[model samples]
Target: MESIWVGERVRVRGIEPEESELLMEFDQDSTFMRNNDRLHPPRSKAGYRHYLESGVGTPNDDEFGAGIESLADRRLVGWFGTNGIDKNSGVFSYGIAIGTDFQRRGYASETIVLLLRYMFGERRFQKCDVEVYAYNTASLNLHQKLGFVEEGRRRRSQYFAGEYHDVVLMGMTIEEYAAAYSLGTVESS
Candidate 1:
C-alpha cells in the first residue's frame, strides 16, 4: 500500500530502494545500536537489500518498514515498523530508531501515535508489542507514557556493551490505545 500517515511533527512512509544508503547509516550508528538489540551481525549493502525485502522473516512472513520523516523540513530522520506480525493472532511487534541528530525531538512519539492509529483502527490489530533494553530509559518512558504496560521482563537476557542487560517487554492492547487516543480525533493530531 502506498500510504503516508502524517502526524503533527512527523510522517511515516514506505521505504524506498534509493534510501538504502540512509538506512545503512542508521545501522552503523553506535548510539542507535546501543539502544536496540540486533539479531544478526551488521549488514552490508547487499545484506540490507535482503533485509529491506524480507524483514529477516520475523514471527511471520508479513513485515513492513517505513521511513520516519520530519514534517517541518521533510527530511528522513529515522525508520520504524513491524518485523514480527501474526495476523491470525491479531498481535504484532514493532520497533523504532531515530538518528542521533533527531533524538529529543517529538518525532518518535508522533510516529508511534500514527502507527498505532493505523494498526488498531485500519488493520484491526488487537495489540502491539515492543521490547526495550533496560539501559534505554528514554524508550521505556516513551512506551509507558504512550499507555503501554510492562507485560514482563527477561532479566539479563541481552548481552551488549560488554555486559548483560535486562530486556523490558511492553504491550498495549487496542482497548488501551482507544482509551489513550480517541480514534475519532487521531487524524487531527
Candidate 2:
C-alpha cells in the first residue's frame, strides 16, 4: 500500500501482517515499555498479528496502528497513530513510540507533524488530544512546541516506578495546526 502520510525524514503507513515480528520486538524493548504505561502483558507474534489484522477496514477502531519508516534508510524507526477516535465529535487521542536506536534523531517530531497534517487536512478532525505522564518532560516540551495547549492535569494519577505521576492533557484544534505549519505548504523531503 502507498504511504498515507509522508514527512521529510519519515513516512507513515499501515502495519503489514508480515511485520508482526517487528512489532513483537518493539514490545520487548524495556526502555520503550517503561516510559509508556502497559495495561496488558507483552504480546506473542501470533497475538500481535491478530491485533494488527483487527484494525484493517475498521474505521472506528479504538486503536489504529501505523508504522513509521525512516526515509534515509527505509528502516522501521517507530510506531504511532490515533487512539480513541470519536467519529461524531471529530476528536482523537494520539500516542507514539520510537525505538531506542531511533531516539534523539527528530523522527518523533517529524512523524507527529505528518500525523497532524493527515488528521487535520485529510481526516477533518476538529481536535487532537494527548495525555502524557509528567515524568516525560521531553514529550511535554515537544507537544507544547508543536502548539498543543495544556488543557488540564490529573494530580498524581499514575503510579510507575514506585512514584505517582501526574497525567498532563494537551490539545490542539485544526485552526491551531493550520497556524503552526500552514498545512499544504509544508515541503516534503
Query: Could you tell me every candidate's TM-score relative to the true structure?
Result: 0.83, 0.83
- Candidate 1 residue 155 Cα shift, in angstroms, is 1.1
Q: Which tens-of-lDDT digit does each residue in 57-88 have in candidate 2?
A: 24443456678889998988888867868879
- What clash pairs does model 1 have? none
Instruction: Report the lDDT of model 2 for residue 72.
Output: 96
For model 2, the run of ten residues with the poorest summed lDDT:
56-65
Model 1 clashes, total count: 0
Clashing pairs in 2: none
